[model samples]
Target chain A: MNPPSGNAGAPLLEFDRVTVRFTDVVALEDVSFRIRPGETRILMGAAGSGKTVLLKTAMGLDRAASGRVVLMGEDITRRPETELFDLRSKVGMLFQESALFDSMTIAQNVAYPLLNQKAIKMEREKMEPAVRDSLRFVELEQTMERYPSELSGGMRRRVAIARAVVTKPPLLLYDSPTAGLDPITAHTIMALIIKERDVDNTTAVVVTYRYQDGNLVANFRYNPNSGRLDPVGSQGTNTIFMVLRDGRLAFEGAQAELEASSDPYIRKFVKRPERDAA
Target chain B: MLDVLKGPVQAVQGFFELTGRAIRNVIAKPLYLNDIFLQMDSIGVGSIPIVLLTGTFTGGIMALQLGRELQQYGQTDQTGTAVSIILVRELGPVLTAVMMAGRNSSGIASELGSMKVTEQIDAMRALGTDPVKKLVTPRMLATNIMLPCLTVIDDFIGMVGGWVIGMIVYNLQSLRYWTTTWQALGWSDVVQGLLKPFVFSFVISLVGCYFGLNTTGGTQGVGRSTTQAVVVAAVSIFVIDLFLGKIFVSGQRGL
Candidate 1:
């Protein structure tokens, strides 16, 4: 069944009445949403609002206690972990804290998915260029030999981005991609997210607290020729804004609808365009 | 009453579940040989010096103590029989296992706890690698292999320590000491020594992995898991040693 929120053509990710529980705690309660091919979703929520849980649930990292999650047209809910690997390789995820392997060099971190993802079988000779190209996409090719601890926080996130997209999967999930960065660095990370979207035509779901990060994603398009993010007019991006409140989806619509939201909790996240200009 | 019993019961269930999966992964496909070797270096090779030092001191102290007791009966020359039996049948396996419980169990818990808290383990799952296959099984296998090897070395080095004491303090004949030490061990004692370590390896590695994977609350939680892993594994070693020793002693007595 098609979700009312998404555009036409089969959904890339669809959560049908999914509820995730941890013993007595209701992490996600009957949450359902849909994202069609090439659509971008900006998920905003307060701390402990089940945002990360939703992302993990979508990835099949955490199984749904009830209902079903369909990813790329496959029913993933209750699928055994062994079977999930092949399905997970078709998606890329950037964790909240970067989650780079501390023991591995940046190159190894980026190369991990390529080497380990059972579906992506590239020879050793071809692997290095893919690793280098992935790092180059983040503009950090020179730091390949360095460990995650040696890099700055923003650099590590970028390296994480490089790792996430190295496989060039059809869908990318960024959990708080700009969560802990300075304003300028957050912008850079958002710009990279947009660039990946525009370049690969990849579907994305970005979880963030910063309304500006969502705004940038909604209103900006990356220009490959200029190597910069260009401000786009109304129809340039197919961005859906979602607000999660206490384990339930409170809002799901376009930027205008999100800004027009009257809910106080939702308003706390919407930073209206007047402030965006200031 | 059931509420009070629930947490520990679930913990035991979860631990066995983890142990079952880890062992099954031993024969499962996609074996991570590199990870296994890396863990071998970390758990096995890295443990050598501490094992050697502790073994020497423990053996030396046992010889000193046993030699004094034998001197009471004018049987100082029989120090080899007492020392070798105690070291092989009890001290070697128990002491080495306790040391590993302290060194490797806490190390595994803290390392994996940090990974867990940082979401690296989740990331590992997302990247199409089973964290248990990649992390826990390798550690389990490495500990299983290494603990026995370390125990043997401890047993041999301990005997050397006993001989050292015989030569210096007791002024006992080297040939007689060596002969008694060699003949002191029966096949049962050897099996018991090796068997205890193999069993203890499972306790040490699985306890560490259990506490680590279950760690919550972030950094402080890592510390708690580390402490719990060490304590649980060490206490378990002694507890299991008592039972195993009882069974072996019973068998020898034809009970």
Candidate 2:
């Protein structure tokens, strides 16, 4: 079969048979998927099923032992880190643990990316507005001077989101952004993600265990006219679902198609409604 | 048997690899000089009290023991010369490095290890900053510069402690004791004292970073890395001193 293509042009991210291994454990095997520009792809999987590994692989944080990763129209599977800098500048990744620098205050954490851009050494005055804007975007503006250790779990995740998007990167990768949050906080984070997608036309790949959250992400579209999210059509082109089982791609399609899949593991995954995914 | 050797061999290779990367980053852009200054203050200033105590105690003890031993042969006057030579030639660099190996090496390992386990290092990379340059380089450079400076202070304080003991305990004339000590210290002794700490600092920094970057298994893994950093750095201090001591000894004999 031919590789997947975008509706407008080349796919923004394409994983052609990517495989990763750590000793005897196979983190990913023959994994393949594509996410087009401005499209949100939700990666669904059970624990140890390669959900987080796939996300890391896309960002070049984990090297694939075989196959290719085509990112931003460039094959970066084996590229050296120096060459990946420009590509990474266009991509923002939020880790599973809300990995804010513990020693830095919330503002410094948010401004780190902008200040480190191509080693340009940005001045504090220039960095202040961007940091303030990102903090306000995450609704954590009042906690700008607090260190990561001082923030609550949910607050740290929000700050992580702010830091990820502080530089206005076009592609956002979120690894379980709502994993440990309360319902209200999770909803808020999900809303902010959709807002980013709508306002910035940001393409994103989210790793999630909650099928309901994934459904909410895949089925909703933000309408600026009403300032509210509305459900997309049954055949919406904005979102896609990719499911993995035992480190291989088991299913990749719309939410309807996923619920209809006959594979027992896929069926089991669809059966569980509000469970946590790895 | 091969496996036993392999661990050390791989560790040595890893140390060299990190050192090479750190040096390249030193010459690269975005040096993170702020972190360098912060570390210099922390490692240099934070350590002054302990180093001071160690220096004074060590110097007084060296003079006291030497004075007693030499008096058995009616050579008590040589105690000051002996203490100055040992302090400048060996004790200053070795003791200061051992203290750093215990303090700064473990600190670096635990900090990096925690960052590794928590994904902050990975996040830094995703943000377009290199962890080696942003995190490790500043620390390595700071400790490298400060270790030598501390050794000089240790040596100077040690000489003064020896002077107190020489005058009060041994009853050596103050003028004679100072003259002999000054005469005993050649440029070679100063070079040896500085050179050892400079090299020892590299070993401590590189080993600490290696274990920290490779940390796994969780918080337990961080503890393991920290312990490994201190043990390896401390042992390496002695091992390196032994080899470097031989080199200086042979050179002196040849001269």
- On TM-score, the candidate that comes out on top is 1
**For each model in turn, which proportion of the native inter-chain contacts is also found?**
0.95, 0.80
Q: What is the lDDT of candidate 2?
A: 0.86
Model 1's CAPRI class is: high
Candidate 2's C-alpha runs over 4 A off are: A1-6, A119-126, A223-228, A233-237, A271-278, B1-8
Tell me the lDDT of model 1 at A252. 87
| TM accuracy, model 2 | 0.94
* Candidate 2: residue B12 lDDT (0-100): 81
**Candidate 2: clashing pairs of residues:** A209-A277
Query: Which ten residues in a row are the worst by lDDT in model 2 chain B?
Result: B3-12
DockQ of each: 0.95, 0.80
TM-score of 1: 0.98
| Predicted structure with the largest lDDT when compared to the true one | 1
